[model samples]
Target: MKIEILGTGCAKCKKTKEAIEKVLKQTGVEAEVIKVEDIEKIMSYGVMITPAVVIDGDVKLAGKVPDEKDIRKWIAK
Candidate 1:
């Protein structure tokens, strides 16, 4: 799975990245986690907020850090 975290490297963005890593480790699923810091790239996703989670190029969550439980559900899908 390809998990992309889109942000401008803020605290929330970092937390999102870490959360994704934790989920991957717990699920034992191989995933490519990327940090999309470029404005153009993030805009392409049509996300006006930072700290967004994009799974397989699909925006999953945006604007804030989602709970770990919610993240697990997203990854499971």
Candidate 2:
């Protein structure tokens, strides 16, 4: 699965990325996590807020860092 964390390296963005990584490790899931810092790319996803989570090219979460369990559930789906 392709997981994209969209932000300009803010604290929330980092937290979101780390949470996702921890979940991936705990679940033993092989997924690609990327940080999207490019403004154009982020805007193209229609994410006006930072710390957005995109799974498989679809926007799943945006604006804030969601709970790890929720993130894992989203990834699982």
Candidate 3:
């Protein structure tokens, strides 16, 4: 699985990445986690908000940090 976190390197963005990493470690889900900080690249996903999450090329959430519950659901295979 591929997980991409799109943001401009803000606090929320960092938290999102950390949260995802924690969940992945706890769940033992192996995935290619990427941080997309470029504006153009983030825009490519059609995400206008910072701190967005894209899983397997599909936009899952945007605007705010996701809680552990949402992160687990998104990362579940």
Candidate 4:
């Protein structure tokens, strides 16, 4: 599974990426985690907010950080 964390390197975006990584490590899930910082690339995803989470090319969470439960559920897919 491919996970994309979209942000411009802000604190919340960093937190979001860390949270997802923590969950992945705890669950032993092997997936690619990418940090998208390019404005054009991010806007192409139709996300106007930072700290968005995209799983397998689909937008899952946006405008905020996701909890552990949310990360687990997303990785399950």
Could you say which candidate leads in lDDT? 4
Worst ten in a row by lDDT for model 4 = 68-77
User: Model 3, range 1-77, lDDT digits (tens) per residue?
Assistant: 99999999999999999999999999999999999989999999889888999999999999999899998898776
Clashing pairs in 3: none
Please write out the lDDT profile of model 2 over residues 1-77, one tens digit for every residue.
Answer: 99999999999999999999999999999999999999999999999998899999989989999798798788784
Question: What is the Cα-based lDDT of residue 32 in candidate 1?
Answer: 89
| Native RMSD of candidate 3 (Å) | 0.7
Clashing pairs in 4: none
Query: Candidates' lDDT values, in order?
Result: 0.89, 0.93, 0.93, 0.95
- Better by lDDT, candidate 3 or 1: 3
Query: Number of the top candidate by TM-score?
Result: 4
Candidate 1, 66: how far from true, in Å?
1.7
In model 4, the runs with Cα more than 4 Å from the true position are: none
- To one decimal, what is the Cα RMSD in angstroms of model 2 from the true structure? 0.8
Deviation from native of the Cα of residue 50 in model 2, angstroms: 0.9
lDDT (Cα) of model 4: 0.95
lDDT of 4 at 21: 92
**Residues 12-65, model 4: lDDT tens digits:** 999999999999999999999999999999999999998999999999989999
User: What are the models' TM-scores?
Assistant: 0.93, 0.96, 0.96, 0.97
CA shift at 11, candidate 3, in angstroms?
0.5
Model 1 regions lying over 4 Å from their true place: none
